[model samples]
Target: MAVKGLNRPVIPFMAYLLAAILLAMTPAICLIPLVDSVEVWQGLEANTRDLRAQTESGILLSMGLVDTGLKLFDNTLNHEMEEAFGPVVAEYERAEGNPGAMDLSRVREELDGRMEIYIINESGVIEYTTYLPELGYDFREIPYFYDRITEIRLGGFFSADRVVAGIPTGEFRKYAYLPSPDHRYLLELGLAPSEFHESRMALKYGDAVRELVNLNPEILKIRIFDCLGTRIVGEECPDDDRRLSLVRQAYRERTTLEVENATARELTRYLFVDLSDNDYASDMSMVVELTYTTKAAEEKVAGMFARQGGVLLFGFALIGCLCAVAMHSLIRPVRNFVEDVDLIASGDLDHPVRVGGSEELVHLGESVSAMVGSLKETIQRVRASEEAIIRHSHTLEEQVRERTADLEESNRMTTLLLDIMRHDISNANNVANLYADLLATEIEEEAEAELLRRAKAGLAKSIEIARDVNTIQHIEGGLPSPGPVDLDRIIRAEIERSPGARITYTGRPVEVLADDLLSEVFTNLIGNAVKFGGPEVGITIRVEELGEEVVVSVEDDGPGIPDAVKPRLFERLSRGTYKESGTGLGLYICRMLITRYGGEIRVEDRPEGGTAIRFSLRRAGTGGEP
Candidate 1:
C-alpha cells in the first residue's frame, strides 16, 4: 500500500505561458528605455558643452587679440623711447654705473613730460631716477616685478611689459627694462599718455565679454570675477550672494562649476582662468561666469523623450500581442492534447484523444490511441481467459470432492485448482489496479481523490495476498526448504514499491532461515500499516539478531488495534476497527509465510500508540531459537 502524493494547484495553460513570456522579456523591456535614456542624455550633454565651449573660445580669442595688439604697440613705442634714452644710458655707463655723472636734462627735454627714466642697481633697488618719488624705492619689495628686473640684469636683454598699474600710485602706465653691458645695472623707462589709456581701455576684458554675449544667443549673460570674488569684467550688474559664493568656491577649488535655475530657465557656468605669468606666485586668475537660457533645449529634450517613450510602449504592446498569438497557436493545442490523454487514461476506452498540434504530437496522440485500443482488446482476452479459469476451477473442485478417499489424486487436483485460482486472481486484480491508477489521476476533488487512492491501495493489498495464496496452497504438497535469504534486500524492494509511505528502517547485513516468499510477510505488515493508518502514517522496520533467531518488528503510528480484535487478528477474513476495504488476507498471508519459514508471528499495541507486528525467524547458519 502506497500513500498518494498531494495534488498541486492547477494553473491554466494560457496564463502560465503568458506569465513565462512576460518574465522572459522583462530585461529587454526595461533595458531598451534605459539604454535609450543614457544615449539621449549623453548626446544632449555633448551638444550643450560644445556650444558653451564656442562662447568661451570667442571671449578668449578677443582677449588674445587685445594682448597681441598691446604687445605690438608697446614694443614699437619702447624701441623709439629706448633710442632717445640711448645718449643718457651711454653717458651713465661710461661713468661706470654712476647715475650722478650722467645728465638726463636733455633726454627729458627730448621726450617732453611723456617719459621718465629710472636707474636700478644689481640689487633691484632704484638708485636714481628722473621720477623723484620712486628714486629710493626697492623693486625687491614687489617680488613679481623684482623677478622680471633680475632677469633683465642677468640676461642683458630688453623686453617691454604689458601696460600695468604703477606701484603705490595705482595709475595705469607702460614700462620697459634693459640691462647694462657690465650686468651691474638695469635701465628702465615709464610712460603715461591720456590718449593711450583711452585706447587701451577699449581693448580690455569687459568690452570683450559684452561682445561675446551679444553674439551668442544661448549665452544669456557673461561676467568675469577675480579670485577675491569681485566682478572684474562685463557690465556692472548687481551681484547676488550665491553668485559671489560660487565664484569664490570655483577659484578656491581651481575647478569649473555649473548651476541651473529651473524657474528662470537659465544655466550659469563658472570657469577659472589664470592669465598672469605667475612664476613668482602672482595669481591673477578670474572666474568667468556664463549664463545660458535653457528653455528651448530642455523643451526639445523633453519632447524627444516623450516620443521615445511612445514608440517603446507601442513596441511593448506589439510584443504582448505576439505572446497572445503564440499562446493560442502553441500552448492551446498542447493543453488540449494533455486533457485528451488524461481523459483516455481514465478508462474512457471508446473516447478519442482529440489533439491538434505539431506532426510529432499528432503522431504521438495516434500512437497512444492505438495503444489504448490494444489494451482494451487485451483486457477483453484476459476477461475471456479469467472466465475459462473460473469454469475450470469449479470443475476441479467438483473432481476433488468426487475423488474423496484417493489421497494422491485429491492432492493433485487441489494443487491444480490452487494454481489456476491464483493465476486468475492475479490477472484480474492487475487489470483493476491499472484502471484505478488511471482514474485516480483524473480526480480533482480532494474527497473523491482520497477515496480513489484508498481503493487503489486496497487493490494492491489484494494482489499481494493473491500471489501469496500459492504459498498457503502449496503447504500441503510440501514447501521449498528455507535457506539464507537476504532480509534487508527484501524489505528495501518493498519500500521502493510503496511510494510516499513514510517508513524508517536501520539496515543490517543479516540473513534469515526463509525462502524467497518471505518478502510477502513484510509487504503485508507494512501495507497493512499504510492501509489502516492512511497517508500520514509513520512506520519503522527493525531487525534484531538474537542468540539463535532474528526478530523483526514493523511498527506504525496508526490507530492501535482494539483488544477485542487482538485474539483472532491473524484469522482468515479478520479486520480491525479502522476497517479499510480489504479481504483481511494481508495479515493472514504474513502469518502463513512466517509459519512456513519456521518463525512465529504476533501483533501487539505499541506503547506510543498504533500497532507493531513482531516476528522471529531462525537465524541462518544457526540452531533453532531458544
Candidate 2:
C-alpha cells in the first residue's frame, strides 16, 4: 500500500509557528512595564523642577518689593526729622540771651501734616510725639526709640516693640532711626509686623507650586523642610531616620537616587532645594521629597502587555489553524495524485485521480488521466500481440502433425503397392526362369543358355525395388522405439546402405538416447547427400558430445543449397531448386522427431562445399538408467 502524503508528520511546521510566536511576543510583553515606569519617573521629576522654579521666583519678587518699601519709609522719616531738628539745634547753639529758645511747638507744628514721627531727646527719651495726644512724654525712658538711637549709629532699620494709639494694640515692629544734625534729637519710623506678614503672604507662590505638585502626584512628593530636613508642608513623610536615609543621601548628594524595593518596585528620590534664598532665616532649606510608587502603573502596563500577549496568542492560534487548513487543502490533491500514480505503477491503470478546486491540480489530474489511458491502450496492444503469437504457434504445430500423418499414410500406400507389384513381377520372372531352365536342360546351345541367364537377372531387380520401398515405409513411419544408440553405428549403417555416395565417418561411439528413429534420420541425410551431391562429391559425418547432448553433423561436398531455400530447409515441402530430388519431408520429419525427444536440427552451408545438416540428441543416461 502506498503511504499517505497528508498523513505525514506535522510537528516540524507546528514547531516553527510556535517558535515564531514566542519570539515575537517575548520582548514586547516583558519590557512594556519597564518603559512605563521610566516614563512616570521622568514626568514626576519635571513637575518637581517646575514647582521649585515658580516658588523661588515668587519669594525673590516678594523680598524685593518689601525691601523697596522699607527703604522709602526710612528715607522720608530721616529727612523730616533732620529738617525739624536742624533749626532747633542751630537756635540752641547760637542763642544770645536765653538758650531756652528751642521752640517745641514750632517744631511740632512745622512737621505736623508731613509725618507721624516721634522726636526723642539726647537721653534716649521721647520728648514729644506728633501723632499722640498725650502731652509731654518722658523725654529719656522709652526703650524702643532709645535702643534704636543707641545701637544703630547712623539710624538704620531694626525690629522693636511698638504701641499703636487708635487700635490700642502693642506688637513687634520694624523701625528706622534718624539722628538730629546737631545731635540733640532722634526720629523713628515704625512698620507693623502684621503688614510685613501680609505683604509676604501676598507674594507667596505656594498655591501655584502646590497645583503643579498635585497635577502629577505619582512621582512627586512636595514637602517643605527646615534647613535640618524637617517636613513642614505637603504629605507627612517618614521622619528623617534610617528609613529616610536614602532621601537624605539624595539631598546631600543633590542628585536623584533610584532604588528597588522588596517587591521589585523602583523608587526614585530627589531633594527639593530651598526655594527661599534667605540669608537671615534660621531654617533656610526646604526639601521637596518626591516619592514615586511606580508599582501600580507598572502593574497596569504589565496587564496591558499581558492582554496584548493574549490577543497575539489568540491571533497566532487562529492563524495557525488557518495555515494548517490551507496546507492540507493545498496538499490533498497532490497526495491523491501520488496514490493514483502508485496504483497505476502497480498495474492498476483503470482508475483515474479526481481533480477539483485548484487549477494546478486540475491540470495535473488531466495529464495523469491521459497517461493512464495511454497505458491501458498499450497493455491491450501487447495482449493482442501475445495472443497472435500463441495462435501462430498452435497452427504451426498442427500443420507439422498433419503433414507427418499424411506422409506416413502415403508411405504405407506406396509400400503396399510396391509389394504387390514386386510379388507379381517376381512370379512372372520365376515362370520365365523356370521356362528358361527347362529349355536349357533340353537344348545343347551354350550361347542361348547364356542369354537365358541374362534374362533371369530381371527378377533380382524386382526384389531390390521391394526392399527399397519397405525401407522408405519404415523410415517415413517415424522409426522404431528409440534406445541407446551410438552415432558411429547410425553413420556406418547409412554409408553401407548407400554405396554410391562417397561417405566418411569421424569420432568414436558417441552414445545418444535414441532408437531406430536415429537410423532413419541418418538414412535420409546420407541419401540426400548422395542424390544431391555431384558424382565426384563426398560425404562426411562428424559426431561430438556437447554436455548432455550428442551433436552429429552429416556434411556433403555437393553444390550448396541455394540461399533462397536455406531459410526453409527444415520445413515440410520446402526443397532446394538444385539437382537434389526427394520427398521434401525428410529433413522436416527429422527435425520434428528430434525436437520431440528434446533435440534440435538445422541446416547450414559448409565452408568448403555443400550443405551440412546438424542435429543434437540427448545423451543416453549414464549407468544405463533411463
Best candidate according to TM-score: 1
lDDT of 2 by residue, 1-626 (tens): 21223233333345445655765665466456556656766675576567545644544454345434444443443343444444444444555322344554455455453334455566655565544543345523434333445544344333222112212122334443555544455554444345444543443334435555555545445444433354445665444565367555655665545554546464544454543322111213344454556666666666666766676677667666766776676567667777777877898877656544445555566777777778778989999999999999999999999999999999889778877876787677677768877877876688877776666545444443444445445556555455677767767777778877787775787777776666767867876776677556888888887778788888888887888887788887667686334556677767766875568898898888678988888888754326
The lDDT of each candidate is: 0.75, 0.58
Residue 6's C-alpha lDDT in candidate 1? Answer: 16
In model 1, the worst 10-residue window by lDDT is 1-10
Q: Write the per-residue lDDT of candidate 1 for residues 113-173, one digit (tens) a residue.
A: 6777778897878887887877788778766567877886788666666566556455666
RMSD of 2: 47.6
Query: Which residue pairs in candidate 1 have backbone atoms (N, alpha carbon, C) closer than 3 angstroms, thus clashing?
Result: none
Best by lDDT: 1
Error of 2 at 431 (Å): 13
